[model samples]
Target chain A: MTPLRHVFFVSDGTGITAETLGHTLLTQFEAVEFKTTTLPFVNSPEKARSTLDFINFIAKDAGLRPLIFSTTVNDEVRAILRTADALFLDLFDLMIHTIELELGVASTHAQGRAHGMANQQKYNSRISAMNYAMEHDDGQSTRDLARADVILIAPSRCGKTPTSLYLALQHGLFATNFPLTEDDLEQQKLPSSLRGLENKCFGLTSEPERLSQIRSERRPGSKYASLAQCAYELRQAEQLYRRAQVPFLNSANMSIEEIATMVMQEKNLRKPTF
Target chain B: MTPLRHVFFVSDGTGITAETLGHTLLTQFEAVEFKTTTLPFVNSPEKARSTLDFINFIAKDAGLRPLIFSTTVNDEVRAILRTADALFLDLFDLMIHTIELELGVASTHAQGRAHGMANQQKYNSRISAMNYAMEHDDGQSTRDLARADVILIAPSRCGKTPTSLYLALQHGLFATNFPLTEDDLEQQKLPSSLRGLENKCFGLTSEPERLSQIRSERRPGSKYASLAQCAYELRQAEQLYRRAQVPFLNSANMSIEEIATMVMQEKNLRKPTF
Candidate 1:
């Protein structure tokens, strides 16, 4: 039987950074099964002690020393958590010292700074980008289409909306998506709303089988969910993209992260500075 | 003048894991200015060499040793990146060895597994959650409100939409948001669509001034953007939350990430296993 390990992502902030790095590290070890939990905002000595007790209890119950991925920046809190009966890997402690030495400066050791609302302008821009994506979603309105950093074009159910939202939310990019309609595809040209914006447009296509499956969940046994219809739309969309010289991607097997990254790279879109 | 540093987040996959950790770490050092860039999909020795070259060029141009936080899992690529004229910090290499020793196993050393579509079911769930958030945004449709893991309720500009979308996108939570209308606030009752789901509802309130400022950007010089209106709505919303026994938070000073994390923690909502 494969051994099971309990992993905890402990941080003084959102714990997102710890969880993200921990998950990425754990994915490399395919032989071990991990049961993971995130304990965020552990900024105080009291919370740190309780967290230690919980980890020690879990270690004793599981009969294995649990693994901890922590990013605590407080010296007092870090001291409290250092005694956990686990493989305590304080991520910040492990690297901050070296960074301090290299840069000849001391870390502030402040808690909850990683994901706080410290930069109001960046936060507002992020929210604005999200609102832009929402307003321009599925070509709902072309009122401010030219203001977009990138516009994703795809056939319906080909993974445009999620990618658009991810770009806006993650990168603070003014992203919009438009679903290719039959009229646009039949004409073998870009959508009327996207005629002169070919340079700012990116297209997404998916395998017919995958597209059909996705559409079937939304509207079962309908022409829109038919494989033939999906294939026809995809072919026409690809042709339109080629004729318009808009960079495109096949998103059948790509996650939204991958698609968003590819689109940003292809379009040379830099995230709005935060 | 604060010292300026060039930092690179280099990775074999989407580089998000690298950038996330690097950013979190850099936030601790407020005395330095960091000019950051991300180089993703550096899975090959060729790409790694080019990455090294770029770092070297930047270091030479800026007359400072660049900081490279890398997560490349391939030995060949890591070897190439190790030769860069910078402070090379391989995140995976630093920690993967310890983890392997603890697990009594060798890592897969796979590239691009962190954010790829290795698990299709999880990807599908994330997409589905995003779609649910969109379909139920601002109480657009309450058809499947019961299916939501958590419902966010707030005034129109109190930040319900971004929080809802973040919860769905980041954590794969079935999150729906409802903008509390004037009638709902005056009645001091939950939305009729959310009457039975109070336990699953989380309220968000902001400072009156902050709320007014945000609304003013949307509809300038309107009653909705007035300080009196914002204060009245917030007071009523807080009363409604207390009366209904629903948990709430003040989001005036919290980022969407912070808001989502707090909601997940308060509601005891676990991210669906991927």
Candidate 2:
């Protein structure tokens, strides 16, 4: 195996986009091996000094050269990253250049101001709408909930939280979900909040055996981890959804991306431009 | 403003990849207005019939021809999509051809299997390994946490789930996260589950004001949504992280793509090639 190269993500704020682009670019080169670690929201000179010290330690090892992808809000931090020996991809530089070329606007060099063209008013309004919906939700909000762009109703352990976040982050959709409790199954009703918004909701079900296996790994000996309970929950959740007119998807066979996209498309939601 | 053109995304399975690529491409064009919708996981002729009906509804009053980016798994579904009088980009054709050429694999006429990669064994193993970690984890699992490809720890209402999924789906990293709860905060401890994994643990925090604002939208009137409580949580979580030597990112300002990329670089994770 090729030795792993250590890469550092130095950020002015959150270093998410740089890391994503960097990761994808790394995939293009199969000959080199890499191991990554991130330092996010690094906005201080002292932090930069410590980061440099860490880089120096890695450099002393001789085998690994640190690669840094930094997102910075401050010029001083950027300057610090620039003086480092690692290969640094500074997003502030890229965004400033791109913005200058695209819109003919000189960058202000002010902190926290950079690239991206989304209309803040519209984006904020959309988010506010979801916030309002979430706040107003009742217990019925838990079922075939229509106020959400995508509603993920799954039993415990079925990856609901991650899937919702993926949809929100990647697609910029207002995705929400609720866990399908036994009460929901016992009542054979979607939580009351979902009554009017049934068409907008989706379900995520996993194989009972798979869920039981997963639960067993966690709790080991609890009644909650029993295969029989898992089967019951799975069957009852499906029945409730079917009666409620909420379409469901099996998460067992799908990745989070697939689930998020499917729900986004089903609701005529716009995918995130970024 | 130009009237929005009807845009459709038809996919064989979940329509996630098609929508992802289509939306990214759409972002490149600002001159045209688009009204987008998707038909997901349409793998059978019956489903194709419904998709066509939906297409007709969208196109009935089209002054300009609609545009479609379709990834079809079924030949019959592809044929149906071809009959629509829209400017369509057949994505399945493009990607399958690209993959086959890159991997030297013969393309098969299989339904609902457009992106079933030839290296299934390797991909499956990676997924299983990550899933296993998720299950075995108990608010604690200290095994070489520092050795993790990427570690994500975010408080409730921050966009951890979406970011983690994007990292996993697009980049193929074994990413796992745990919530930063009140208990973890009061104790000033990284979950006992994450105790020794300090080097591997990355915290995701947001401005308490921003987080409270976010949570209030979801659960108004509850203590969980109180700005004061949120601020306290944010402060305590950061303090705990500092004491525990865990690095963290703020989620308020970053997009999901940015967060995923940031994590990928921090962990020195890899993306799949073929």
Candidate 3:
């Protein structure tokens, strides 16, 4: 068994980006056990000094160099953390210099600009998108169907709501989702509400075995959780997608982020040039 | 102004984390212009070789090395990428060696484990929480009030819905929110639906100027969007929080990520020691 090691993600802002990067890297090495901690909003020199001291203490106690993943952009604060007995991976300083050279421009070296609340329009758009996704979830509010940027059609519990919400939150795209009902599946036809709006429609399907496993958690031993039902629904959904020429993806192996992004990409909801 | 440079974020999995970290780092260099692109699920050696070739071509075209931020774990793939004519910063390879040395364990050298669909329970919990957040968003549904791990109270458009959704999507926390209506503000009392759940309640307040600006976009110059009304509502909300002993934060300067994390930390809805 591998010994547990200390992992710290420190940042001047929310620390989410640091944690996401650090955690993804750590997940690559399977045998190691990591006790990870995140310390956010360490924007000041004093705070950085104290955090470095704490990391040093942890290194001494463990008799190994603790791993540090940091995203602080301030030079004074970063200098303080460099003194700690750890492998300091300063994400900002590592690549920004090369990018500056390539761009042939001086950097601002400003703090808190990444996720700053400076753009009210973008922020409001995200909020409004979130609300729109929630309102139109599971075909609840079809009144504003014309306003939806992308409409997801899938059976119940096939990862629709979460992906819809993710698209809205991450990209400020208005997304709505509908659960394909039994009648629609039986006839392999688009739901009446979704007939005229096929241009912006996207479909999500999955393997029947995996879909059964997922449905079993919510409704044990019911027909809805049966493998046969999942297979039938998935087959009908695919047929509908093919007949209607609507682009679709199988969500059996992809995460919510992957599904949301692929739909956004193939449907041209996000401008790739941007 | 800086020259335009191509920036690539490559990953074996979803690539969201790599893009997030890279984007945050790039934001600090304000004067530089970046054309950022993400390539996800780069898990194979053949794909890695093709990606390297593309990167080298971009380098030759622009007369400068493109910047790549990658999280690929496989050694064979990393070696292929190292031959590219670009400044390669492989986030996974950067720290995995130190972690393996500290833990004294051989790595599994896995691919796609970062956001893989391995843990079904945790993934389902996140979905459930997102649904819960949507159901109880902005005083929408109070039926399952007690099921919420945290309840946020604030005036209209004070960043409640986004924060609640973030807490759920990131941490699998069941969060609900309600807007403090004018009657509650005038009386300076917790809403009747939220009175019993005061122990789990949190509050968000922002500057009157910012609040007015945010509200004016939704309701064009209504009393709710007036500066004086915003100030009055904010004052009453603070008073109510003090009387109820609910912890609060000023969202005027913080992002949705920061607000959600701080609330989760202070409310103990999450185990901070973890």
Predicted structure with the largest DockQ when compared to the true one? 1
> What TM-score do all the candidates reach, one by one?
0.98, 0.55, 0.92
Better of 1 and 3 by lDDT: 1
The candidates' DockQ values read: 0.72, 0.10, 0.54
Interface RMSD, candidates in the order listed: 1.5, 9.2, 2.9
The stretch of ten residues in a row with the least summed lDDT in candidate 2 chain A is A109-118
lDDT of 1 by residue, A1-274 (tens): 7768999999988898998889899999887888999999999999999999999999999999899999999899989898988887877877888888888899988788878887999889989999999989999989988899999999999889999999999899999999888998998878887878888899999999999999999999999999999999999999988988889999999988889888988888866332
Cα displacement (angstroms), candidate 1, residue B57, comes to 1.6
**Global lDDT of each model?**
0.90, 0.62, 0.83
Model 3 lDDT tens row, A92-149: 6667786566556667777766666646667777788888987888999888899999
Interface RMSD of 1: 1.5
lDDT of 2 by residue, B1-274 (tens): 6566787878766565455445544543555566777677788888888888878777787766677777675668888888876766664454444433432345555544433332446545555444534432323455555545666776787765445545555555656667887887887877767655677777888988878877886788899999889888888888877887776778777655556656655655645333
| Model 3 RMSD in angstroms | 2.6
Better of 2 and 3 by lDDT: 3
Residue B243 lDDT in candidate 1: 93
lDDT of 1: 0.90
lDDT of 1 at B237: 95
How much TM-score does chain B earn in each model? 0.97, 0.66, 0.95
What 10-residue stretch in candidate 2 chain B is worst by lDDT?
B130-139
DockQ, structure candidate 1: 0.72
TM-score of 2: 0.55
